[model samples]
Target chain A: MGEGMIQDQSDEDLMKAVAKANQSAFRTLVNRHMGRANTIAMRSLPRREDAEEAVQDSFCKIWVNAASFDPDKAKFMTWFVRILTNTCLDKIRSNPPRAGDIDALADVLADDAASYDAQYGQKREGEAIRKAVQTLPDRQRMAVILCYFEEMTNPQAAEVLGINVKALEGLLVRARRDLKGRLGAGEDNDG
Target chain B: MTDDDLKKRLRAWTVPAPDSGLADRIVMNALRHPQKMPWSLRLGKTLETWLLDWNAGAIYKCASLAMIVVIGLSIGYSSPYAGGADTISIVDLAMGGMNEWEGS
Candidate 1:
């Protein structure tokens, strides 16, 4: 392809080509988004294996539905994240985690804080923050995870949760207030 | 601290890295069974390409013409003119009676 033609091929164009069974175009799109999708899935789903499956499912869904994707409704990344998050959430809800699993996660969080602080030399504050986040209400915790850990924008996070942008903002606000209160910060702490 | 600051700190806390090879497995699976194109889309593209083919276009035109000719022949066979002369004789008798009645 000529440089001009290549320049004109946006992600949407590539997706359209993939819909026509263009292998190279499909590969390019998969390679570009796979890491991000995997990250989001892993964060949302309780099990690593389930997360991987969800990511794969999301990619397949994207491929089948590529032609129907409306650029007017959302950016490609946002749309992709929405699919990934929803897939993970569906899997998680279908198979609730075992009691031991929740405990295992709490242990993992503690270990993570220790190791990260050891490597970076920021101990007390990291531990405090982790504890505060862990104490957040389940919905607030999910919102914080999707918004912060998964790096999703507010609108995209809202889409994943099936809520409007304003609702998402309220959730975030309440989450922040709760976290600050749990951390022994007064209401005026603003976090 | 600001909420953003707290968020930054929370992000620093260790979330387990997903199991290794997940990405590779996903990509391989995707490559093995790429999404099946919608049936409608596949059918439409096939029709479009078939219509664009010269031989297909010629065949289509010939079939259309054949259809038109068959319809024309059927219409001709069923036409009023194709009815026997007895029907015309009946009409003429009815017309003659009407004329006589009008004259009287």
Candidate 2:
């Protein structure tokens, strides 16, 4: 099919084509989702390079498992995000964060850490808040990342994490509380 | 922090959009590795290999002949109904001195 035709195809249709080992369809898919995949990876892992590695690893996996995916079970975006999340997590575990990893996460957590599309620079207050967020437990950090940073709906984030909505909610509540405590009383909820 | 502040800061986070060339790179990498076919495709390929891709009409004839031989052997030698429903077995017939060895 023509490029326009491929671009117009639904994610599921492209996925079906991918299952047939269609290289063009796979290219279209990678172009479409790579941005958000990168964003999620940046938030999930400690370094930009690590995030890149994770995204690359994930695309390779998607290629391998394309035929096994069932559209009825989940949306393509959700499934892809789940794979990216798992890949990033594995990369994070395999290479333990350096001693200054918290500093690295804090640096990347800034408002302008990657804001390529716009002039998004992190303010001092926001930096403190993000550092607080980075200090959360892995699951709690993931909860915050998906629900807040990635702007995923609670149910959707829960689905991606392979947890029930209630469990995800509990993690968010705890993460928020932890962030608030770290940020302190009056400034905790500051804008 | 306030939910709005948190969301705003997150929106500002400088996460890189993957390089435009990365997609092409991934496609090339995948091509080099030629992924395994799904089971359904493999099954279809198997049918084509064993049945459709050969000297077409002869495959079915040979398959049919093989089936006939297997069925005939089962009935004549290993079949429980060899003597009859009420009869015991080929072994029983031999032990009772009711039959001689085949080709004797």
Candidate 3:
């Protein structure tokens, strides 16, 4: 198939082709989802290099397990998020963050802020938030990343975490309460 | 911080866009490992589960062994020379293809 046609194919269809060991289809899938995967990893992990490594590992896993994926059980993004999230968690546990890892996450924020001029106070606030986020427990931090940072719906986030909506809501409530204590007052009823 | 305030704060913490060559690197690394076909994966899973199943009674074990033996015999009997004109009996081979054993 032409590149355009392959690009136009649905993720499930592309996954089916990937199951047959089609490199083009795999490339297409990777290009389509790489940014989101990177974003999730960056939000979850402490260092940029670790986040990138986690993302790479996750995509490699997706390729290796493409045959076992069943779309009927879950959507492609949901499954991908699950894999990416777990990969990040495993990376974190295997190599716990060093003392100055907070600087690394702040450095990523600083790099992002560099594009805008004279946003010094904003940059500081961003760094504070980033550090506070990193201090959260693994699951709570994930809940914050998916719901608050990524703006994913509660049900979708719950599905990605393999939990029911009620349990996810509990996580979000606790996350927000903890963040409130760490950074100041905050009440988010949507969670 | 209110809900909107927290959301704004969270949004301020931005992740840099991945480098231009990131996707290429990931694709190259992943392609080094070939994926298994769906059928083969299923077969592997089935065999793994069967091998790991330790709850079978003696009857099941006997039945499995009998089935294997039957399959082996069937494959042996289906060979090209099993009943062909070239077939040779054990006695004939022992006597060097003679009708009876030669006296030594």
Candidate 4:
């Protein structure tokens, strides 16, 4: 059993272990995906405290629902990000911001900068990229976070967003175009 | 910049490390509540498994009983002396007595 376990410790394995109440295996999974999960939450909610809460809530849900995971349908991270994204979206819709709320916008930008600093040691360029990402529409932003930031494939991102792959591709295209526009880069400019 | 380049740069942005206690807190919360598996689901699974086992056992028993019945019926039908020879002795006895009386 030990040999078999050593040979086959995929996310699925860890999840099964989690279902059996294995704390070590659960911790391993959290360590592996927590950073990306946090990023997705932060991108969607654009606030540190809320994002952190969302991540924690999502992980908790995952722990509870580990037995329901279907490996054939989606990878573990894809499933996980879907939960995180939904939690963030629920938070957003529950309290829709007023039109032209500059304070809200500034708070979002400041949160992004602070999160980046917390993660990457104060890179101005990183903050700029995040600010640009913040300009994307919600769905487009989600697609980008899942596709690029989380390193998920288009189909996986689409699954997380409950959209078709073609739609996901379009969202990604528009998101990239928007990012390029806001970052002062032209169609020819290659970062 | 090209879209690919912009995407690449955006991808390069890193997420800062979360709060040091975040994982512990999440794990602790999970341990505390531990999603309750619904009784209905548990009952359904149990019933499904039991039904499968019962169906297989019933099928085997029914097939065995059928084979036994078939073999018993075949043996009974193929026996030549089953119900045919019992009255033959009485008929022979009566015929012999009649023949003797006629001869006397």
Candidate 3 residue lDDT tens string, A87-148: 99899899988879988556655676586766755786667777778888888899899999
Q: Which residue pairs in candidate 2 have backbone atoms (N, alpha carbon, C) closer than 3 angstroms, thus clashing?
A: A111-A122, A112-A122, A113-B14, A114-B14, A114-B15, A115-B14
lDDT of 4 by residue, A1-191 (tens): 35446345898878877777777777777877888788777767656777898888888888888777778877887788788888887877775434443235444446655746554333445656666776577889889888787778887888899999999999988887788677775323534
Give each model's whole-structure lDDT: 0.69, 0.76, 0.83, 0.75
Model 1 chain B: ten consecutive residues of lowest lDDT: B10-19
lDDT of 2 by residue, B5-102 (tens): 54675554454567777777767776666576668878887778777666655767798989999999887876566556444565686665744544
Per-model interface RMSD values are: 3.6, 2.7, 1.4, 2.3
lDDT of 3: 0.83
Q: How does the DockQ of candidate 4 come out?
A: 0.34
Displacement of the residue B60 alpha carbon in candidate 2, Å: 12
Q: Considering only the true interface residues, what is the Cα RMSD of candidate 4 after superposition?
A: 2.3
Q: Ten residues in a row with the worst lDDT in model 1 chain A?
A: A119-128
The CAPRI category of model 1 is acceptable
Best first by lDDT, ranked:
3, 2, 4, 1
Clashing pairs in 4: A119-B16, A119-B17, A185-B1, A186-B1, A189-B1, A189-B2, A191-B5
How good is model 1 by TM-score? 0.68
How far in Å is the alpha carbon of A181 misplaced in model 2?
2.5
**TM-scores for candidates 1 onward, in order:** 0.68, 0.74, 0.73, 0.65
Better of 2 and 3 by TM-score: 2
Distance from true location, Cα of A81 in model 3, Å: 0.4
